[model samples]
Target: MPNTTDIELRGVSFAYEGVPVLEDVNLSIRSRELICVVGPNGGGKTTLLKLILGLLRPDRGEVRLFGGPPRRGRLRVGYMPQYGRYDPQFPVTVTDVVLLGRLGRGGLAGRFAFYRAADRKAARDALALLGMDAAARRPFAALSAGQRQRVLIARALCCQPDLLLLDEPTANVDTVIEARLFEILRELNRRMTIVVVTHDLGFVSQWVQTAVCVNRTVVVHPTSALDGNAIRDLYGDEVRMVRHHDFLSKGGHDDE
Candidate 1:
């Protein structure tokens, strides 16, 4: 049997103030699939993500999440944005940050509920999943860049989402932590569909099964079928393909 569809975009087109972004795009993402979305900067990567999140309405065509309108399925989705700003001196613990995920369960009223015992437990479990439980009481600003990213991911997981979306998750982290993060994501993929927007093609080839190349249009290719020529087609001739082995040879460590 075919896998259940988690996301579908049919002839989707979007433009910002008459400047075209994505046009004539059709794609489908299936359950438990790990996908990497790669494209040039400003080539509609973020636009496509917004469409999937129902944060933007396409100029033309349709977007469906789990066979329904995207808005209808929002609660089942967890999103970690590319850049999030936080005050270094903000008096918030890692556990407190993760509990923010539970706010979606009851909206404003639930947030004001001061986070019930169950919410605390769920947050703790999410932290444990990322091996971040020990840092739960640490001030958010006290963690490293990689640890912060993991905490944000834990926050996303606290929602108990069936689908996880991450944008440039490895952008600010070292190679070792990046590899570890992908290991965590790979484990999560056994139970949830994951879509990540990344520029690290080597990591994509190593970890994900599918690649979605988005420019003015979008094309989906199985990672095994992705070749240097295919990457050049998506990123142009100036782009170079770095093998995963080369990355690891340069003091990059893989998850044990």
Candidate 2:
């Protein structure tokens, strides 16, 4: 499955309560690909992710993942939403927060019983991957924004997914944090496909060859092919590119 098609969308159109959002969109994401989903506000970027996740039904056309319906294929996917719905006052520990991810695989009964040793190990491994293992006992609400983001991403990884979806993982983080986030993403991309939804047009990770632009419709363009016209089409003429280096590193991927 190293080079197999992981996600496919064909002639897909979606409307929310009769308001047109995306129309006639076609896309394919291959295994182990690192993709950035970029577009202007209200351009249906989030909507596109929802469609692929099977959270929303398309008005027309087909959406497929791993050659099947998203609901089935999604078990292999890890998702980090644009927003963390947790109340800041909620006193959940970092490890507890991550264990929530295991619910999908652990079943509702596991929620009442103690987590299995395997589940605990998975949670620990996920925390270690994000370099937050040291803070596993910390309160979730007490962590900084960047730290919280990483913890959420760790939760996503707790599912041990083959496809990872992150929505604005760098939204409010500083450039340093953003850089670090991408560094982790670079590492994660090796055995799994990654889809990042970001507004950062300057996001030029060397390994990210494709930027899927969604603006009512969808367009796939090479990062190098994104010039002013493409920027204008995606963001309505409000952007400037800032280059960043030192993201990719040589390594073997998690192809298993």
How high is the CA lDDT of each candidate model?
0.83, 0.81
Model 2 weakest 10-residue run by lDDT: 240-249
Model 1 scores what on Cα lDDT? 0.83
**Model 1 / residue 39 / CA error / Å:** 1.1
Candidate 2 similarity to native, TM-score: 0.83
Candidate 1 C-alpha lDDT tens digits along 75-192: 8998887645777789999998899888867656585767788899999999998789999999998998778888888888898899999888887788887888889889989989
Name the 10 consecutive residues with the lowest summed lDDT in model 1. 237-246
Q: TM-score, each model?
A: 0.83, 0.83
RMSD of each: 6.8, 9.1
lDDT of 2: 0.81
lDDT (Cα, tens digit) per residue for candidate 2, span 54-101: 999899999999899999888898988864577999889999999987
